[model samples]
Target: MGQICPSTASPLCVGHRHLRHSLLSHGRSKAPTEFPDLSFLPPEMAISILSHLSATELCLAGCVNEYWQELADSELLWKGLCYSDWGNIDSFLPDGMVPIQSYKRLYLLMDDGSSLFNGDSVSGLEFLLNNGVVGPSDRHIGCFLHESRRLHADKVLRLLQDRRGVLDELVGLLDFHDVFLPDALRKFFTEVPAPKVRGDFLEHLLTKFSRRYFECNRDMGLPQDTTYVLCYSLIMLSVDLGSPHVKNKMTKREFIRNLRGAVQGTPGDYLVNLYDNIYLHGHVAKKSHYKVYNNADF
Candidate 1:
């Protein structure tokens, strides 16, 4: 019986057959299962990943979702427009550009107007005045200049000139002349063409602007007389632009009249004489206060 058991250890024995079956079953159990399905992540996490894309990329991605379309079109997202340099706003256009030209025109007009206001010298004023020889169509920009000490009155005329050189009184003048005039005077003034009067007036004003008449005047060896020039210039401007209502609105008349009164007391004898000739006589001394005016306003 022991001899029979020994023989079963050979390759063809039933014990050997059982061992083969066990090995086969163990190998099948160890085989790798298919990889776990990983496609069901949260939608919020996916959106968070996509939020940091650039403007163009965001634009394209917007086609994929309503929220993205709105975010992409936001003005805050337009870094190109927001960070644009003085005249460089034109460079941000895409290949099929049409709106770019509109943006450029607006920006250039605004820049030209602003330069005259913030500029520290006659150079900027002259440049802006020259540009104004052509019209600036942006009404908001024009209105902005109206409120700021940005440009000399002459420069404002130049801009009107450039706008097709239309001679218009109401276009440039900021007041109602009739209100300030007697009825007879108002009738005479109304008979004149506004454009012709404005054109003629502009020419005369330019001569004063050319002479730098309203500049500080202090450095022309007459520092003590400088303030008079400024005071007179301010009053003259107020008179030219102000209506009778404005003059009537003068709680500040004492201040203005006092300065006008002191015009005679200024240290420079020649300058005092000059102010009388110009302010009262409507004539001006031919002197350039470009540097002086620039310093005061700037």
Candidate 2:
């Protein structure tokens, strides 16, 4: 008669008990093992090491095992990201969240709620600070207008009267890393106090986007017209921020002069060159090929 080993089908024939320990040892060695001695590190050390990973990478780390999962979702780790990325979270704390708040949900709110697909259309001031506004698209133009109607008088006036409204500037949408959008927008939006007039908003945008462009994308070889597209859009939007003067229609010549003025006023040397190149090197109205954009294009 023989008995089976607990983990194996091999029979322990009569008087073969001495072989059992060796068999058990061999079977146990086959179990999976994680990285050696990781758990030995103190929690603070662990948090410091793991904090360098981006949010996406942190999520992958959490799947390794339960202990690693806890470390990945550690409040200390996300707190660092929240402060580092979005600045002090105290300002964003909602009313109901009394003693504490979920940094993860707050992160999602900033990240997800900013996208065109996910967020509600908030006021220009709030939207700029939150990084929740998207640049205009065919469908988005109407949506932006709709949002304008929903707000209070101050916010609505700020939107329409500010020269750097959704129409006037793309804000940080083009130049910044989307992850840093919330913080970047907040810092820059706060740099200048609420602007009472439209031109001030345009000036802020020209200054800000130009500086950011020079800093980040200066070396990038953007096409002449592509560069012109940005210049034209900003210039046109600024000049046409409010209702176009019905008394005297905005003519093509007036628009071009406005472009020149905006280009001259912008801070970057390269931006000035791009504007010059577009106006001089290429015939903007070559052979009467100038395409007219109606109000809808704006």
Candidate 3:
């Protein structure tokens, strides 16, 4: 055979070249595509981007990875959300009460629906009540009372004392058919306010709210006893609705039985009607004969 050309040298050389080519091709095909890393972004830019996300969206973003978690849990972000949902946090906090957790935790607590009912026990309630920039209104106060059903009387007293027009708001809570005045009162008096203040407040509540109910349902043939004890009846109904010892869902008999002792001499039919109306509508039924009383009458 003619002398082997150097280019065709040995079978091993050809095999080596083929193996090298295969390795290069495989490396090129298997290479991972590069992606832009959010971690490389400036923290301020990252926070600014995350600021647009809602509380729920931010929570989901936090689960993505470590870097995003840091940005998602930023106090600024949460504080902003808290401010948006509930104005200045400091305005609502009781004089001596301080938050026990991060703004993030506080926001989450407020975001939870159950927190509205658990205010008495949850420490987060300290920051949950928000009076807004201008301050708390009757509607806001009523809502606060409704949400803070279990809040301590002392704390509620402090909150109310600091605010103007609280008595009017407290009465307004009753005027609206939707508010559970009994539970609201129970929450405010869990520990009881000063004797004079308590007396005046209850008197106002009884005079205004009870009289309104009476005026609204004057044509219903309600017993005078029902009218006289309507405020007391509301208190008893609150106990029935809130007391852990009693069944949550009460029958007509159970409802009447619970209130009959307090509202003695009121007919069962009247009591049942009152209970159904108050429980279902937060006030007695208003008939066509209902008359609007002047504020002076209260």
Candidate 4:
């Protein structure tokens, strides 16, 4: 009879090791199941899908891989995001002025500006003024004005005007509309002492008014000083609207005529838009959209 092998050196142990090796080899032979490759999709389709992502999400998606990074950095995606959040770029900025060359850079700048201004940090004002030195293009100024609309527009303008060369630096880069319109709107409402406006409506009106103001300033070729006076005229118009002593509703034609006289330039389209926004849209109410509008509406 043959002797039995010890348990440690048994043929059964050898068989078990062979089985384990076979299983391991089998597992290794099969390919890994990966997630669907976004890169496999058409570029347009991928962008369309990415468009659903918020600015923050889009930025995060870029971190996944190089393929995603390429698509995530797309100009179209960033540009759409910009328009969605801030509306027409030309409306917020001067005509034909591309503040940052890339939409991605502009979006980042705007986002950073919004966060910095809205955040609790005290450095926002200093950063924005950049110590009265020449800053970036008017695009940056537009971003500053648009983002900081939550702050007192008059106060911001006053601060800028008080700082030597800051306002001039802004004016030199692009037309002063980026700063002027928002500041003027606030100044107007303050002087009128109209009813306080809701925050939402004030933001809307500021954007709309700024867009119209920009168009007017562009068409008339008005100098910076003239634009400044024109902003003052807008304040006077607000006074006329709010004053019960005036009694008569000023006609659109009359409003434009008055603005022209005050600024000594044709601000017809702008004044008409302004008059319609206030008179037709019921911007001026007994409760007075005045106070909030002063801080917000451009």
Instruction: Note the Cα lDDT for every prediction shown.
Output: 0.36, 0.44, 0.51, 0.53
Tens digits of per-residue lDDT for model 2 on 1-298? 6546455533323114433343455567584333333244555666777999887888888898888898998888777765665444453443333554567665555445434222233433354345433233322332333322122323332343443444333333334433122223223333222233336554555455445644455455433334334544534433343334634544445545655554453435544443444343332211211111111122
Candidate RMSDs in order: 25.7, 16.3, 17.2, 16.4
Deviation (Å) of 93 in candidate 3: 14
Candidate achieving higher lDDT, 2 or 3: 3
Worst-scoring 10-residue span by lDDT in model 4: 283-292
lDDT of 3 by residue, 199-280 (tens): 4555544554555455445655544345546655554564465446877656667777777776676677656665665566
Best by TM-score: 4
Candidates by TM-score, descending order: 4, 2, 3, 1
RMSD of 1: 25.7
Pairs clashing in candidate 1?
A: 117-150, 132-159, 133-162, 134-162, 135-162, 135-163, 167-195
How do the candidates rank by lDDT, highest first? 4, 3, 2, 1
Extract clashing residue pairs from model 4.
Answer: 186-294, 195-287, 195-288, 195-289, 195-290, 196-288, 206-298
Report the lDDT of model 4 for residue 69: 97
Local error of candidate 1 at 90, Å? 18
Best by lDDT: 4
Candidate 2 positional error at 27, Å? 27
Per-model tally of clashing residue pairs: 7, 1, 0, 7
Q: Candidate 4, residues 273-293: lDDT per residue as tens digits?
A: 767665543433223221234
Candidate 1: misplaced stretches above 4 Å?
1-109, 116-149, 152-178, 181-298
